[model samples]
Target: MTLPTPPRLTLTPEELRALTTLYTTDGAWTVEEGRRHCDRLDVLLAAGVLMPVQTLLGMMYQLSPQGRLQVFGTKDLAHSLRRQQDRAYLRLCLQHYGWTRTTPHTTRHLTNYLGGRQLIEVMTDGGPALVGGQMTSGGYRGLAIKEIGERLRSPALHDRFQVILFTPRPSMGQTAAAPFANFLTLIPLVPAGEPDIHYGVPTRAQYVPPPPPWDTDFEWDTPHITASMAVRLRRDDSPLPRSSVAILCEPRSARIARFKADLTMDLAIADTQLRRHYGLSAEDIEGVPFVDAVLRPMHANTSLEVQTAVYLRSATLAYRNDAALMHLVGVGEMRRHLNVVYPSQWTVSTAGRHRIEEPDALWHRGAFDVAVEYDTGEYKLHHVLRKLDGFASRGLRGPVWGVPSARRAAFLQGEVGSRLMEPPLVTQWWLPETPFMV
Candidate 1:
């Protein structure tokens, strides 16, 4: 939100203080005394008999704190006496008409004796003449007389009086000023008993706005992390296992060595038995097609390190999909750095087909292709078996073997990992150096 610029003022704090003191102290002088003081100061020097100083003093008294005149020095006595006389005249008129004057001024005693019984008749009968003649061309005093007439005539008003007085009007001038009757006669001089009128004026603060309510539940300091994170990280030690093994059964990293070794050992044993039975030398069977078939199992035990790297990259991508680091190193960059290598022999036969019996198990079978497809129909049964075993070792369930009923049932019900390395309808070849299994 934009803020307003602070206000600039020419007056210094000291000067403002002096001005305030002068206004408050000298402002309480009688109207005539205030006028004379203005005349001497060469201020408020208007041409009329009633000086503007009187107007200024009257306004200050009504508007300032406490709404009462302040005490000026001895030189201000004459002006004070003149103002007292005017107030006295008004009080005399009020008391003479049998209208209550709460505090009659000292100067009003003589007029009270003369006009005491005649004021009501004079005011009632001469309402129009008093209002129009006195109010139309008269100054501040004239307006006061007019207002008194209006209040007396108003049917809605109760506790009516002949006159009401306001020491200093709220605003000055013909248009802005409150009507004398309204300020002086209409508003009641409410007794001190009512809490609102202890000082004979409205109790509301003039210009201040009401303050905002307190916010008891507001917090200045909130916890940084969310509750879910707190719960997930609440362990006393390491949250994950010390070491993990991930397998990628692609052509580059397949466990072919162990399979080949096992197959070679089995083949050698079978060949020895066969040769012994048939009385044939090992060299005689060297170029047989069965020998090459036996060697196929060796490809099963490939490089575990390369496969682990690929799986680690895939896991990272899956886990840190929304991390800032992932964005910093773009997804394409990450894929290049950690490529997923699957066995070349394991082709996706039915790339987009859904299984009729196990439709809901598609994700578990690795059948749902996110970026690459994995299916059994287009791949050899032996290749699928190897891939399934590799995936199972790495905490994943492999795809279902889609073959004829008997063959598929045999494949599913067989020792899944062992059969993948078992020779088929051909004698297996051998490799000596590689381990039989990982």
Candidate 2:
């Protein structure tokens, strides 16, 4: 079944006058003034001259300048203001006042109304167009609408608008072959532009990356524990999804002195847990006088400072990988690598194992291994750190490493003059031959 169309909301003449007055006034109104305005509105509503109180209030809220409408009513009514349906209704009312309405599915009507030079110019004129909460900054909207206007100005571009509307099946995952049951003409105004482009409407769908391998190592489990603790300590409340974690481990002989100082003081686990697991009490974990004396310094002194540098090196590599992934996927994947790698006796061997290699390699061999056998997580972490160190130590003077980009290749070839050629023109409109619409 199709979704129900929202009702059209309008205000009576008296209610409109009140709204106008409110807009014109400054500072909080006295109780008497508020009561008088409410009484006038109530009288009109009683006589069927004004819309329902809720509808009227919703419209008023939308019309008010940002942060100004919250002072209008009782606490009970204020609570309902947060609802999305209320916000949508308010938007509908504003749209009715500002622009004439057509059937929701009428792409032709919308295009005819919005496509005209006069209307496009006006919309792009940096005027207030009621978008939900606060009025959008005209400059921002103008830039967007201007791009649209530029596209529509060209007949070649005008033909490119491909509007499609469909009730996407909830069960079907994103694929190359899913057919949309309904379609509408979409006008490509801005077209696709860098850094990224978003067209059509937004939806609330979770992006699930391809499934993990059957024998995926659980090394990710440790990073998750550490990351959760870090997030808790920082009091970060962001709702962004978590993807992968990078762990940087620095293994040193346990006899090294000043090793604890190199680690983050706020351990992921409490001293009690550390003591319970390692046979060292809280005092011993904290390096109390007696306990500190018992743990002998190594013949070769290794400072916490040295350990931290190694960990930072590893973390930086992890960051590079993250940046690369984000470049490929519009969304940034979670970087779960540990900021500090701790010394541990744990070891794993993969003398003859096979597994998928690089992230990109997955698409090619379906699976491939860089080496015959290695501790996948530890090896990757160490390799990335070592590569970063090499780049830094060599002053990046010679051949650059990692997945080389066109930009990098140009930079390295001493073709600086040729690389500074004029920027390519961005086509804002679509040609008639193209399959997709804006």
Candidate 3:
């Protein structure tokens, strides 16, 4: 009978690290030279992956030919050294850039020895780089580190850059506004006086981005897991983490939905957002329990969070179009930032039987309290009329319907204008002209 092909063996991270350190020596390394070497060298030595030689200069360790064969499956130390060196250089490159591409020159070198795993590409300011060659597992697995496709709310899950790398140890300088940072922006890395000295990354970055939002991780949907993997995610058959209902029900996500100029809040990260971040298969955007619960809440209070999300999403669209708030004020960069008071902050109704109507939001535009409604276009005609009638009772001005687009705005205008004699004070998709302009 023919023997099955022997499973190709590969080096563990520790072993690989030790071998790379040893490979740097011209012959043998004195113990003194091994001071900053990997601590796993002893493990490698015990395994006969390296042997000590008694030389005129005292004792030194050298990788034995037998050790080379055992460790690398090849006796050619030079060849294996080159591979390790390439892996290190490439890994360091990926670390520094967060994402980078190989040039045609480097690609020519890597293409010949190429082997691969799940293909990943890095997009830099330079361009997308297809890192060709043996992409070993461990430090480089899962998603390719890049900043795009990331959700940027407060309690951010990713910084501007995502890199699979060893934590860089760099000395920090004084935390003050330094005018020198302008010149630093043109320079990318450091020159530590080594191989790529002026080429490789420095101990400190010349240009540092502003501090990112607070970082956070997700509570994945791994349910019914045994003690084995349950502990892996800090769970013991607990129902809360995977329960989208529980997640969306929390106040944090809703609070985040209502935002300002540089909107910062946390995530009740939707299923689609999470999947897109990891490059998982595209699925429905309205995540389970999240959308259903948001759309079909048991009560008004239950739907508050969903409304808050819509409120923000619509606000963002308006902000982009420079939307007018109740035709009183504009919302965008060149214009003034809106100081919004959300529904939860509404004062209780004092009039007998006056069902305390709360519009989606009220934009305090210095001289005006412009009432705003974030319409999802799902409201029934009666529901829409009821909401409008409630706003009409407020008696200061007509309400602003923050619809999805100009088409929706026009449609809403036609619907409401035909019924109400006053019509909407302004039916506009773009930001409002100040009430003074009105």
Candidate 4:
């Protein structure tokens, strides 16, 4: 008789130690280093646990997020540890709402807990969301719905259950979950003393088409790479020594479009004067705005801008460190630079369709990578910090806020800084009294 196959082997302590080494260290591992650095490298490499990342140094291996979780046996050590407080608050909310843990099965689709015979699927997010991928309402909705159906298959658990989708902050306008509120519950998972959470579908129309493109004067022989393409090239050209966050404020959509168009015109005019001084060619001058895609009309929002600013600042910091020179990356240039970095963070379904989160600008110099948020005195301190926390999760340090008034800037720095490990930097930008007419 054929003997039953033995259970797959568990990872040896030696293998786990090797994985911990790769997980704790940053940068790619060379083939020679991989073989010699740790005894289990060959085992992990054969197990498809190490992923290849192409760097300036060459091909190197690093433990993928999944690989790390596999060897570590728990997610507590992952970068997700950054949001532990938020997750704890989410648990508090569930406890407050009377949800209880009744079952303890370790299945892949393990139900979080049970409440009076109803199975609950809980999706928790502590970062900016609603645009897609992992943290959005849509992503959680799909998972919860699928799990609900699976649980209903058990005759003991019926359709009396509800899925709780918890986010530390609300969506951009409190409208992202309107379309599906009937099917699920969406709630902000903040602690007491913060703003009272509101739960109404926004009235604004859902699908806003982008404004028309601007007309241009010059047509060069070579077509410019799209802004998205340019940003990706910069990211690949130099990976940051460490991940970072940059902050910046964004005005309304109309103002955002006008600023980009004006920057393109101003840059072209200034380049004409400085071309000879800098000994640059026509191709070089033309390529500047082309790379930025400032001439292209696109929508921008504050949320996405925050993500972009972090990336642009990080890229600038990396470049400055390597070249010993600074580059002039302005408002419009920063917007274009975000195209590559922010899209990946977006949910897969919304990635191509959504506009870049708009920001006024970003700055990166050595250890001073900062997101320059332009505060219009509109955001609540807690709401603003929630957005910043999203950036911090990606490896940013501190926000350098640009407030319209000194009094408000001081208030923000004091109130917001007390909560953070390092105080936020504040600066005052004297915004124009009225919108600048074209």
Please list the C-alpha lDDT of all candidates, in the order they appear.
0.25, 0.23, 0.33, 0.34
lDDT of 1 at 51: 21
Which is the winner by lDDT between candidate 2 and candidate 3? 3
Q: Give the per-residue Cα lDDT of candidate 1 at 23.
A: 45
TM-score of each: 0.14, 0.18, 0.21, 0.23
| TM-score between candidate 3 and the true structure | 0.21
lDDT digits (tens) for residues 64-178 of candidate 2: 2111222332112111121322233323323333533234443243345344322211121123121221111101122333344344434323443322211112221222112
Better of 1 and 3 by lDDT: 3
Better of 2 and 4 by TM-score: 4
- Winner by lDDT: 4
Residue range 1-438, candidate 1, lDDT tens digits:
122422322333543443344344322333443443443322222211122211111211111111111122221212231233233333333333444422333222322322222121223221311111110001134344454445444431343323333222222233423444342332222111112221332221111122233532442233322344334433423121111011112121122222232223221222322221122223322232221000011122211001000011111121111111112112211111222222221222221122322211222115432211122123465755555555455443333322212343354446452533221111111111112111
Provide backbone clash counts, one per model. Answer: 23, 10, 11, 14
Off by over 4 Å in 4: 1-77, 81-86, 98-139, 142-193, 196-349, 352-438
lDDT of 3 at 11: 54
The runs of at least 3 residues in candidate 2 whose Cα sits more than 4 Å from the true structure, single-residue gaps closed, are 1-99, 103-143, 154-333, 336-438
Residue-wise C-alpha lDDT for candidate 4, range 1-438, written one tens digit per residue: 222423333577776776676555323345555676667765665555665532212234566544655776643334321122223334345554555343334222334333232333432342111111111121233344345334433422333333445544445323544544444356654322122222532110111123334423343333123345335534665211111111111122332233334333222112211221121223332222211101101111111110011111112121111001101222222223333223223111111121223223334435544454444455686767775775566464444454434566567667886544334323211111111110
